[model samples]
Target chain A: MVLIYIDHSEKEIKKSSHEAISYGAAIAKQLGCSAEALLLGTVNDDLTALGKLGASKVHQLNNESLNNFDAKVHASLIATAATNLNAEVIVFAHNINGKAIAPAVAVKLDAGIVTGACSLPDLQNGFEVTKTVFSGKAFAHIKIETPKKVIAINQNSFGIQNFEASATVVEMTLPIPAASVKVTNVNKIIGEIPLTEANLVVSGGRGLKGPENWGILLDLAKALGAATACSRPVSDSDWRPHHEHVGQTGIQIAPNLYIAIGISGAIQHLAGVNRSKTIVVINKDPEAPFFKAADYGVVGDAFEVVPALTAAISKMKHNE
Target chain B: MNILVCISKTPDTTAKIAFTEGNTKFDENGVQWIINPYDEWYSLVRAIEIKEKDPTTNIHLITVGGPEAEPIIRKALALGGDEAIRVNSNSNDSYVIAQQIAAIAKQGSYDLIMTGKETIDYNSACIGSMLSAILDLPYVSLANHLEVNGNTASVQREIEGGEETNEVILPMIISCQKGMAEQRIPNMRGIMAARTKPLKVVEPLATNAHTSIKEFSLPPSKTGVKLIAPDQMDELVKLLKEEAKVI
Candidate 1:
């Protein structure tokens, strides 16, 4: 069995899990095995729908301590569940939660692990997976030698495929350990399309001059129904929240379309957004390095160009 | 307080990515190596911050690499650390590196273990959590704000769209990121002091790497940018839809 770890956010299954389930299902099909899912914490999502996504069975482990994110507790339970199900391969969504626990679970199970895998295993000679290395500058094809393996699938790398099947839900009762990490407080951005999962994003930087001038960027994001992001300097100056910062050290987003306004395309900043399908750079400086990586470049003042683009997009949507 | 901070040497941010030897190995020629920024700017700085508050705190640095990594570890010592240790082997596999560091931490019996969220080169973002698990310690990932109160640590970590606070007892591990601490440069005195700091080199434990890189390739470079005038917004939209098909 291929055990896919289903990650849940706010009692809802994360959208990225759909890609993981589909990827795991593909691998299971190659191995002539069943693809099953294992979810921790109480979830509000309909487990039956997961069958359509790929999993044949959804194993749910409900525990209060599991509700909060604890890498130690989660990794141990996942190892146990994988053992209980006699899983040959374990799959995860290479998001924040998946990256945190997958390696630990691998250690527990003595399984070889690969994080940020963009492809399924190629069993031609050995079980090999390709992953992005050096941020996105290069790719490395790695082969796992261990019998039991763990692979974390990148969110946008795999497309989700639906099948005509209903998954059986299984209630798992494991010896849940007490979590040592105490929850002190909870602070989350409410009701905003998260940049990690956003299909489109409009980002700004210090080139915006000041925080007050951010209305132009926000208006464009709203027009496209896209998530808003910023460069490190803007967030460091407290002009934007830290969570909005997208760079090598900040949030790593791979939105389908990314629009950068007034942000210099520094190597560090590019490391995070280089995975985007299409990059549109709006900067007055033609010499900016970001232009070289951009698919489309507008060498004009963002203040003049962004508003016009937003209006055009709004108008186009209205007409459609 | 005894704090063990794990660091790695990586190519400078602007280093050109290339491969040699039939695309099996990274070409290190002319590539400037520096201590990973997240390790130097965040994890090590935060450890120094804790030491400055209570002068008795001991900050020890460790790295899993060959002698080539000594300079990077020494540079980290200049920033702030009591001593350093270098595992006398070079391996890029995350598990092997974690096992080597875990051995040191077990003997050191440190109260707090720190590491950057991920190295800029490989970006595995798994070593800290892996080490924590191997040592049976509580772990927190991507901690931005941390405060130590005796035996307990209050940490605020970055999630997908927000942050959350968690408290853990001593002998725990946490990975640091942007908001954790400000970057610091070593002054003349610190540089001179680092020259004489004790840096012990130990042989790596017998460990097998379960994974090996088969090949390396670079991502396709973007072609000529389609430059459009600012006033020609309509044309750009048409290009985005009809040519790029992003819209």
Candidate 2:
């Protein structure tokens, strides 16, 4: 059986996992096998709704203890689940949680692993897989010779292809190990899209001048319904929270579109966001390093250009 | 309380990457190695925080690499660790590296294991989770903030679209990222004291091998930027519609 690991937050399915499930179901179809799903933790949505994504069955370990992600415990339980189902191919969404647990599961199963995979495995040619290397700069084709294989599919690589089918929901009991890591209290800042998963992002830098001017950037981001990010200096200067920083020293992101206003791209900064599919730079400095990497560059004041762009986008959306 | 933080020696972020003669290994010549930045947050800073919370805490830095990795190990020691350990091995496979760490953690019977979410060199955030699996412990990844009280820890991790906070029990592994703690530089006195600290060097135990890298290559450089005239908004729109198709 081919197994897909469904990643969810607050019982709602993640966009990335939809792609993974589609990818897994496609692979299983190609192999002339059945596609199944394994969901860890509690989910609020209907389990059978997963059938729309491609899974024929949903194996749920609904223990509330599994709801909070503990990578070690997750890996152990996943390894056991894979063994129980006699899974030949294991698929995961190449997000933060998948990056942590997939390799560990591969180790437990003694299976060959491929991470950051951007395409379906070429099953006709020795089960070859392609993955992003150099921080999403290039692709490397790898083949796993081990009988059991693990693939962590990159986000946005595969489009979601939903099919109408009724999926049987099976509740299975697996040994839950005692957690070594204790959780005392949770402190979270609510009400902002995470930079990693945002489809559109608007980021700023020192050019914004000070923290007070941050509202302008936030305005543009809000207009586009995009996530807000900052250069390392902005965060270092306390203009933005450290989590909002995106660079080699900060969070590396690969989004559909990344727009920068008033930020000069350093090599470190580029390394983190270079994976973005499309880059748009609006900086007054014509010689800013960021312009060299941008697919579109406007050598004009961000104050002038951003408002115009925002207005144009809003107008286009309204017309649509 | 005894704490063990596993550190990895990695090429500095600024170093130019190159492959060996046969494209088999990452070229290390003339490359500067630093204590992996992620490890610095999850391991060293957290260890110091524990020591500050209780002055009796003993924190040790450990790495699985050759003698050449000592200076980087010493740098981590200077930051806050009480001592250091260098396992004589150089392997890129995550499983092998985790095996060495699990062996050390088991032998030391340490209460806590901390490491970076992923080493920047390979961008593989596997070791901590793999070690956790091997050691039969709970693990947290991408912890942007962490705090401990007694045997419980409250950690916040970056999730898709937002952040999630969890309360976990101790004797677990936590892979840290930014927002966990600010990076700290060793003081002059700490640097001087690090030179005298004890560093134990030992041979790595047998490793369970799994996979290998076939080759390494650089990414294709992005094309030069296309300049769109500020006043020619119509032309820019036409270009985006016809040429880029990103809009």
Candidate 3:
């Protein structure tokens, strides 16, 4: 059996989990096995609806403590579930949570684990999985020699596909481990589209000049319904919150469209956002390194060009 | 207080990646190795800061690699680590590396264990959490800020949209990221001190790697950029609308 770990936050299922389910389902189909999902905590989404993405069954351990992520506890629970099901392959979305727990689970099960997997395993001769290495600059094909295997798919690498199926949901009663950490306070920005989940992202760098000039970027982001991000230098300069920084040293996002304004595409910065489907760079410097990676490039001043683009988008929306 | 920082040696960011032996092995020729930026900049520096705050604290560096990795470990010591431990094994498998670190950590009874969020080379982001499981300690990954008070540590980590603050007790594991601490440069005086620092090489515990690399290949290079003049803003918008369809 192929088991997929469904990652959820605050009862809402994450977008990456859907992709993982589809990827796991495809793997199961390729291996001639059944695809199942494991949910550790209570989730609001209908488990049956998840079946459309391709799981035959959903095993849920509805424990309140499980809602808060503890790497040790989650690893133990998932390891138990994988063992109980006699899973040949286990899948996880290589998000923050999955990256934390997958290796521990791999250690517990003695499974050959591959994280940041970009493509499905080739089962023709041996189980070879291709994964991103060198911070997205290269790919390495890894082969697992162990009987049990664990694979964590990178976000946005595999698009989600839906099929016609109804998955049976089963509640599981397993021993829960004590959490080693406690939540003192959570300062979460409510109602903003997360960078990881956003299909469109508008990011800026020091080219915006200061925090006061951020209105133009916000206008463009609001008009496009996109999340806002910044370069590492911008965050370091305190022009934007550190959470908004997207680079090798910051949050890595794989949005469908990444619009970068005034940011010189440093190699470290490119390491984070290079996975975006379409890169649009707006910079006054024609020789900016980011232009080399952009799908579409516009050589212009951000102060003038961003406002014009925002106005044009607003007008386009008005016409609609 | 004893603090343990896990260090890794990785190729520099600008190093041209190439494979040898029918693309089955990483070509190490003409490659420059440095302490992984994440390890040196965040994890090791933060541990040093903690030691600075408490004069009684001792910071130790550890790595799982062959003799070539000793220079990287010594560089870490120059940045204020008290001692170094080298587990003599060179394996790309994260599980094996974690087991080795966990075994050493168990013997040391460290109050705090730290590592970078992930190495730039392999980018597994797994060693710290795996060590936590093996040691059965609290684990926090990608911690941006950390504050320790007595037995409890308050850590702020980035989530999707915002940040989550966690308070974990001592004997815990944390994977450091940016904002945890500032990067420190080693001075000549520190370099001299590092040369005298104790770097004990030990044999690794018997642990088998579960995974092996079949081959390596670089991502296809990007095609040359298509530039549109500033006056051709509408043309760019039209292309985005009709050609790319991302908007």
The number of the candidate with the highest DockQ is 1
Scoring the B chain of model 3 against the true B chain gives a TM-score of 0.96
Q: Model 1 over residues A107-224: C-alpha lDDT tens digits?
A: 9999999998988899997999999888888899999999999999887888789899989999999988888798888888887988898989999988899999999999999988
Better of 2 and 3 by lDDT: 3
The most accurate candidate by lDDT is 1
Cα distance off (Å), candidate 3, residue B205:
2.6
**Candidate 1 vs candidate 2, DockQ winner:** 1
- lDDT tens readout by residue for model 3, A1-320: 99999998889889999999999999999999999999999988999998899999999998877889887788999999999999999999999889988988888888989999999999876898999998888899999989999999999999998798889999999989888778777777887898888999999999889999999999999998999999999999899987889988788888989999999999989999998988999999999999999998889999988888887777777877
Q: Which CAPRI tier for candidate 1?
A: medium
Q: Residue by residue across A1-320, what tens digits does model 2's lDDT show?
A: 89999887667778788889899999999889999999988888888988988999999998887776667778888999999999999999989889879988998888877877877887775787877665554456666768899889887777789798868999989879876444444444568887877878899988888999878788778877889999999999999988889987688887777888889988888878888888888889999999888988899977777777766666665766
Tens-place lDDT per residue, model 1, B54-169, is: 99999999999989998898899899899999999888889999999999999987999999988988888889879878998999988899999999999998777888899999
Comparing candidate 1 with candidate 3, which one achieves the higher lDDT? 1
lDDT of 2 by residue, B1-247 (tens): 7889889987787777777867657778898888888888555787798798898889988999998898987788788899998888987767788888888788886767888877777776778878776887777788777777787777777776556777777777888888777789989888888999999988888865565666565666768788876665556545654676655
lDDT of 1 at A153: 88
Chain B TM-scores across candidates = 0.97, 0.94, 0.96
* Least accurate 10 contiguous residues by lDDT in model 2 chain A: A180-189
